[model samples]
Structures are given as C-alpha cells and as structure tokens.
Target chain A: MKSFVVARDLLREAASRRWFLALGLGITLMLVVMGLSLRMDVVDGALAATRLFGKSMNTQIRAADVALRPAFVASSYLIFYGGLLFGVVACADFGPSLLAPGRIEHLLSLPVRRFELVVGTFLGVLALALLGALYGAGGLVLIFGVKTGVFSGRLIVSALLASVTFSAIYGAMLTVAIAARSAALSAASGGALVLLGIVAGERERIAEFFDSGISRTIFRGLTLFLPRVSSLARSAGEIAGSEPVDPAALTSMLLGLVVFGLAALSLGIHLFERKDF
Target chain B: MRRVAWLVAFAALLGLSAFLMSRGDKPKKPERVLKAEFPRHPRDWEEERNRKRRTLPPAAPRPGEDEGIQRKRDPLLVALPVEKGKSSVVFEVAALKESPIGQIWLDCMLEEQAENKRRGRGRDDFKERFGIDLLQDVERIAMSSSKVAVLSVAQGAGRFDKSGWPKRTFGEKGAIWEDTEGRSVFATWGDELVLAGVDVKEIEAAIARLESKSPPQAPPIPDWSAYGDIYGVLSPEELADMLPEEQGEIAARIRAAIDRVDLHVDTSEDVAIVADVNGSNMDDVTDLAKSMGAALSLARAGAEDQGDDRLRELLDYATIKPRDGRFTVDVALPLEVLKQMGPCRKRDAAPSSSQ
Candidate 1:
C-alpha cells in the first residue's frame, strides 16, 4: 500500500535525522543505569527485599514474587505516563515538519493522497512511540527478570498496553500540529489532554462534587469523549500484579481510547483536505 | 480499499473493547452483621490532634461543662500508663456481652455453668472460688503488664477473706484497699468503680489518674476506643517476650521488625479488625508489610484448598497497607462469614430449640 510505503519512508527519514537512534541510545542508557542501580536481596527464589538507590523499601519472607508486585505496578504507571510524555516530545514535530512548505509541496505533488500522507505520518510516529515503549518498559522487565528470575508476561503485555494508550495522545498531538503548525502548541495540547484524561478517569467522583443539574450533565458530557487513561492504566498495572481486573472495563477503555484517537485523526484529515497551501 | 481496511481494523477494536467491557466485574454487595457497641473517642480527641497539626480551634466541648459530669461518663475506670514498657488490654465487658461473638461466648459459659450446677455446684462455688462472677457482676476488665483489675457492680467489696492476707488502707482519702503481698488490691469509688489489680502502686496510680481533675491523656490507640468494641495496645518488646519458647526465631523477627502493636477488633454487622504494627522506621515497617501481605496470601490459598470458604472469603478482604512508619494489617469479615461460626449458628438455632 502507498500508505505503508510512505510510513516506511517516514521511518527512514526519522532514522536519518537521528531521532530513532537518539531515542534508542537514551533508552539503553536509562535501562543500563536502572539495571545497575536495582538491587534485590533474594533468598531461595523469593525476593526477600528490595533496595532502590541504597534505600531498603520492601521486605518479604518465603513469598514468591509478592514483593516484585509493587515494582511491576510502579513500572506500569511509569510506562503509561512516561510513554505519553515521551511521545509528546518525540512526535510533536513530526506532523508540523511534514507540513513544512517545501516538503508539503513536494509530497503533495507526488502520487500520495493527502489523507494517506496524514495517515502514514500518524502511523509512522505511532510505530516510533511503540518502539520506544518496548525498549524502555521491555528492557526494565528483562533486567528485573534477570535479577529476580521471574520473567513476567504481564509486564510484557503492560508495555504493549502502554503503547496502545499513547496512540490516543499521539492522535490528538497530530491534530493540534496539523491545525496550528506549531510543535509547542501540539505538545502542550497533548500534555493537557493527558491531564484531562486523568481527571476524566475520576469522572464519577467529580460528579459527586456537583448537584444533579445541567452543570453536572455538561461536565459528564465533556468527559465522555476523553479516554479514561488513568483507570485503564491502573487496570493494566493490576493485571501485572495478579490482581483481579474487570475485562469489560478494560475492553471499554481500550475501545474508547482507540475511538478517540481515530476521531482526532479524522478531524485532522478534514482540516488537511481544506488547507489551501 | 485502504480506507476499508482501516475501517475494518477500527471496527474490530471497537468490538474487542466492547467484549472486554462486558467482561468487567460487577460490584460486590456487602452483607450486614452484628457489631460491637462501646464508648469511642470523644470528638475532642481527633479535634485536638487536628488542631495540633493545623493549629485550629479546639474541637472538644467548651470547658464550661462541669467536672462531675465528665468523671461520671469517662469510659475507663483505670488510667493505663501508656508508656514504652507497659502493655495494656481493656475489654468493654458490657459491650462485648452485647456483641454476637460475646453472645456465643456467654452461651458456652452458661452451658458450662449448667453442667456444673447439674453436678450439684451452686453459684456460690463461682463466687467463693473465683471471687467474682463476671456474668453477673463485672462491667469491665482491665489488664496491664503488671496487673489485672476487674470492675464489678456486686456488693461486699471486702468479702474475700483469704488467710494470712494483710490488708492496708492507702490513697489520700484512705478509699483504696490493698493486701500486704500486693497480690490483690481493691477499691470502690461511688457505686460502680470496683477496681482491683496485682500491684498496689499501679492500683493507686490508676485511682489517682481516674480521680484527678485533668482530662485523661491520649491513649496509644486514639481512634480505636472511640470506634471499636474491643481494643488493646501491646508493647512489641513485651509481646515478643510473651512468645512461646519454641517460637524463638519468629519472636526474634517480630522484635526486630516491630516496636509497638495496636490492636482493635470491631465485631458488629461486619468483622472489622486492624493490627497496627509500628516499627523503628518506614523501612522496617515496609518490610513487615510485604511479609504480612505474603502471609495473608498463603493463608488464603491454604484456606481455599481446605474448603474453608468463610476463612478464604475473610482472608480475601485482609490486606497489609503501609501507614506512617507503620503497617496496618486489616481484616474485614462479612456478615455471611460471621454467621458460619458454630456458636453463631447455635444461637440462631436456640429459639427453635425453645419452641
């Protein structure tokens, strides 16, 4: 497909610009530091205790991987919030850069449709974000696995879930960039959306603050479109900890997030089609 | 063609998300059960703490309220010295008797009493031998590391005439009575406060503490007495010493990990219990918390395998959450689970038996 080819070309462009390499290097450095700093005093296959940065934080008896749960959960929160922020920084300019005067003129002159150009660029940035999440979250899992000898599939799935969460944020970032043509605006909007999504996660609690009226209705309606990122990410973390999770809630969250992302992408397409550049 | 493919993918995700949402767990409905009823912390205690923390206005009742009223309503007849070395346990005997567990305990005791009576033993045996009939006379029991005291409503305070017992009259008003051996000290204040303890000094201190005009000092468990039916505080060092000789290693570990232990049990419509174990620092407490969580998980698993559904359900609600430099092991028993107790079932069947 032309879109796939264009996506591949964008990936090559990112590589040439040292974006992917810098991300990979930074992730590797963080992972190495994390690997070195993390110390687990394990006795008889059970994580007896954990010491983070020379401070003993947790201890356990003959419990198997019970101590690793906090780390697993904390790592999930990091991946969810960390990946969102990282994507905002890394993919913020991808859309604006694509719409640059000379680049846009050349790309538009080619056989690639404008929608394809938008979709391809979005997919390309998403792929980059996914790779970054895999490296950062996946590397931590591998390192902890080596140290504790408990290779958790839950951690692996959490990394992928985190990547999926970013797609929603990245979609909004793409829309903001395509509209404003400013990376700063794009990044700020994406960050704001993440914050709003967190608030939306507690929509039920917030509704309790207001009376049952139009104002409450308006607040509830405004949150309907926002992804329940915090709850979804918390559930993802729960999965890793072997805590019970409501599959229906998680599935709804995933579906809601993907729908929000696609809606934003559609809006970007509509804006792109009408642009007279 | 590309748009169609994208649409299909989006549709698939939507379907999957819906399916997942459908699989979400429904909220569980909690069952009601009997609860312990007892005197709780006065509003002033928490207000005082909050004021200390935030420098706010005093939350206690205005000081205009007279001393006579406050003294009469005070929950404990003994003022326990909540110091570093001493451990204190106070049972609200009246409240316990009102609770489901206490009712069962009473039933068992009554059954034992019936058996004793069937053997030609009378109420005099319990009264003469034990020097107290807790079922008929006692209102509350207070125990310290050094002494055990009972408050009774019965008459004739000096009825116990054990031979070779030297009686001494002490206290400012000579209201306190004591034995030379300090084995038993008894005192009567007004009509209700019949206090006794092993140590005359402790008994005097408790009497003076109770009789004093100043407001009682804050206890180790500030909120528990106000909220819980049964509550107690334990010096971790003393508790470790009390451990069985065979459990030397576990005792050592407990001593190493804990500095103080606060226990509160609420057996109302639900069984809500908390054992707050404070350690030397956050690190020690956190370690204890992890171990507690693991132990709970193991216990739950064992209970499940043994088909102890009630225990498994109760343990499922048990958790170890870290507090400020301490860890609280919380267990909430559902009413349904509490009903599973043999005594509770027997009590339910009691009316049927009478019919």
Candidate 2:
C-alpha cells in the first residue's frame, strides 16, 4: 500500500513537471502533420492510389493492408526503440532526484520501507513509459486506421511490449542510480544496456565472427543472461506484418524479461536497505 | 534473516531468467523447399549467372577440321536452308511439351481448341485432319523466312498418312501438293519431315538439299547452341526492325554496332533467357553494353519511384554482362509471376467442361 502511495506521488511529480504535457504535445503535432499531408484513394478495400504532401506514392492498385504493411512494420520498430530511448532519457533524473541528500533523509522518516521506496520508484517510471508509448504508438495507429481504414491491432500490442521491455531497462537504471546517486550514470547505464541487449539478440550470429577459442566462449556466456531486446522488436514487426511467429518462444522471452526486471529491482532494494542514510 | 531472504530471492529470479532465456527458441532457418528457386541474394544470382555462362558447351568443331570429334547434329537445324543474313528460329517442341511451363501452355491451348471445336468454327479434331495428334506427335518446328519445316514423331508410330495428298513428285521420295488457291505449297520429305512455303521453288530446293542433290551448306544454327528449349540467331537487320520507330537513331546505332544475336530460352523451370549480342568490334560492344546497362538502370529506378513492384522485380533480375568481345543479357521470370500472368484458374472450369 505504501508502494502504491509512493508511485502516486511520483506520478504527481511528473504531472507537475509538465513531462506528460510535453509528450502529449509532441504526439499531437505528429498526428496533425500526418492527417493533413496524407491522402488515399480506396476502392473496394484496395488502395487505388496514395499521395503524401500532394505527391503520388503509388500508382497501381493493391489491397490496402498489403500496401501499408511496410509502413506498419517501420512504425512498430520506431515505437519499440524510440520509446525505450525516450524512457531512458525522460525518467533518468527521477530516481536520483528521489535519493537526493535532503529528500532521502526526509523520506526515510516516513512510513515507507527502504525496499518499498525502490520498488515504487521503479513502478512509477514504468508507468511513465507505458503512458508515453500509448500516446505515441496509439496515435500513429489511429491515424493510419482513419486514413487507410485498415486497423491493425499489432501496433498497439507492440506499444505494450515496448513498455514491458522498458521495465527491464528502468530496473537497471534504478539500481545504478541507487548505487551511484548520479542521474548521468543512470541514463548512461540504460543506454549501454540497450546496446548490450541488441548485441545479445544477435549473439549467435555474431559468434561466427570469432575463431574457436576461450574468448568466443566467454563472449557467448557473458551475453547469455541479457534480454534479447532486438529480437522482441523484430517479432513485433513480424506480427505487424501478419507473419507467423512461435507463441511459445514469445511467451518464454517475455517471462524472461519480466523476471530479469524483478531481479534487478530486488538488487537495488538490497543496496538501498544497507545505506546509512 | 529478511535481508538474507531478499538476496536468495534475487539469486533465484536471476537463475530462472537464465533458464527461460535458454529455453527461448533459436531463429529457424527459412523453408525454401516448395518455393520456386530464385536467388535470394544479388551475389548468389551473380554467381549463378557466371556459372551458367561458364558451363555452356564449347562451340562445335568445324567439319573436316576436327576429324576425331564425334557430335550428333540436330537434324532440324540441318534441314533449314542457310542464308547469309537471314534469321532462323527452332523450337524444341517435344522438349518444351515435357516442361512444366509447356504443360500449362499446352493445357491452355488445348482448352481453347476444344472451345473452338464446340463452337463449330474449326476442324472436328486436329489428329483426324493431320493424321497425327497435334499436341502429342509434333517433335520440332524450324522456321526461316517464309518456309516452315515440322518434324513429327508420328512417323515412328506409322501414323503419318499422305494418302489424301496430290502426288506431284519433287526430289526422290518427296511429294508436293499445291493449295486450292495456288498460293502455297506443302511438301513432304521422307516420312518424318513436312515443309510448307509460299514459293514452290524454295520448297523444291529445300527438298533437293535434303536429298543431297546440291552441295551442302553449314546449318544455320550450330548444334552447340541448339540445347535450349527455344534457340535462334537473329540478324542485325531483324533486331533493328524490332525496335520502336521513334528510336530510329538508337536502332541505327545498334545495327552499326551489332553483328548478330544468339538467343536461347530455357523453360524447364523458370523462364531463363540469355541473348548473346556479337558486335563488329570490342569498343563497339563495350559502348553498346554500357548503353544497355544504363537504360536498364534508368527503367528500374523509374519503376521503383512509381512503386511498380512487378516491373521492378523483373528489372532487378535483368543484367547485361560483357565477356569474350560480346555481351549477354540474362533475364528470368519466376513461375509464380508467370502463373499470375496466365489465364485465371477460375475460368479453368470452362476448359474442364469442354474436356
């Protein structure tokens, strides 16, 4: 219950700082630009012609969904990676600001436990990420649906997946901030993890580059525990394109990512509990 | 004790994550077994093109020069009269009829023929009128100028009947019949070869050549180039005439630069066409190849800009490669695209009813 209160307070702080307003304004501007510039001539569920900014893009008629598949795929990827980068940059200062010298002493005097504070901050930042993803990805989906009259649910699902993926990233950011008490270090660590996760997704193919030796073995072993973020993004794109995906693999990967996030948060709480402050 | 429990739970979750990560599926290799064989990468396509060019059989040894060389000449090419600059084309009808593409084409043709028969617009049956099954008995067809020669397997089956023809004898064992209007002549040479022409003198001369009553000339198309389902050599003048009238300057340039074009189409799988254009000189060939490559690139870019994927894909596979003082243009159309271009299967029901 105290964690929920702490999370609510963080949301209030975000709202007071105008972070949500900025995100909403940016998304609205994009939606307006798209709505004003794009035109489609549809006949019997086929796109007879399409134009952007008064310039024709396609001449031959094709099934509306088929013609827009590449656009959906590109949007899904942008949401996945762009949302993570936004969360990393926007939510970085929240943790260090919570653990600031004067605020830490004042918060420690409250009814909340040390672990609850860490868990709350993690949940709060994750909520911010979820809201941002929905506004950005959902706005694009709505625009495409209105213009093309082909509503695909996969982009919305991709937005949700991006938030879940960001949870794992934010957990690490919180852990770094708790240890170092520096916002720059937290954001830098998040950026590095995103890069590492991309490498981890392709580690098997990258392994072929190295010769058979201990160095290759160590590289493989070190990356084995990192979340496969790029693979998740690719799966999102594939789903958007209506391609078949293995549900068992997707479920297992999602579970692994969530568990990793919990583990990182637990480590941060452990570090926070022993601090003198 | 509570702090220790936290550490234990963190360790347990991390271990579980590692296990789950390992359980996640590895990327599956693409399944290409049932799909038509198209090169998935440009480099693979380049290698395939190079390999095909490298593996064409060496040119046939000149007669009387390589006495030890034993090569069976294609009788169809041998039957055609050799003219200095005339274009000749030979269709391996039997081989094409056995290929998948040929089967589709034959099915469509037979269906149309059956429809025509039902409408009372043509012969009741091609086999009855010709004394051989038109679809099954024709082995090869060769054409040059106004003359056409057909080779039939029906001779081996003793189905070739000449009983209804006027028996005006040409060369020995050759008979000629004039059409009712006296505008065309049909001649049969031996049991296997039938020749049709607008001129009686040419048909008689061809028959005389077949009988060796005159001196022999080299076959218009060599045996080495006769391997493909459709093979031919086009004269420079014929090539020039094929171009658009608006491109007269280009046509003139092409005629001045090009000597002849050797064309081949392999329809056993996808339609793979190769045309080798011989030039008057190395520099001319190089310039012509550069122009062709530039034209292809411009067309491909236009297709891409217009978002015409079908034309773009076709242009993607079209390439001009220069080697051995000549240039080869290779193009491939996948069977999938061909199936789409063919008659719709929904209309196939009409054919089945006629069948």
TM-score of chain B of each: 0.60, 0.73
Each model's TM-score, in the order given?
0.57, 0.58
What is the alpha-carbon lDDT of model 2 when measured against the actual structure? 0.74
- When summed lDDT is taken over every stretch of 10 residues in candidate 1 chain A, the lowest stretch is A58-67
DockQ of each: 0.09, 0.18
| lDDT digits (tens) for residues B1-355 of candidate 2 | 7877777877898888867875663764552222233221224543353344232223345555564553333445666778767788877787788877778866766666767788754333545644656556667778885465545445742232443545488767677887667676777776777777788887887776666622357767765565577778888887888877865765787789998888887777878887888987998876666666555655665787899988876765666666667888777776665654564353555567788
What are the candidates' C-alpha RMSDs?
11.1, 12.4
* Candidate 1 lDDT tens digits, B113-224: 6667777665557476436666667755666675645463555532444423544544543355566665677665444556677667766676666555454555444432
Candidate 2 Cα misplacement greater than 4 A, ranges: A18-20, B31-355
Note the Cα lDDT for every prediction shown.
0.67, 0.74
User: TM-score (chain B) for model 2?
Assistant: 0.73
TM-score of chain A of each: 0.91, 0.95
Model 2 has a DockQ score of 0.18
Q: Candidate 1 residues A1-277, lDDT tens each?
A: 7878778887888887665687778889988987888888654444556677888776333334555777788888888787888777767888899999999999999998998998898888778777777777779778888987767788777878888778877887888898999999999998998898887777777877989999899987776567676777777788877676766667767777776677677767767877888
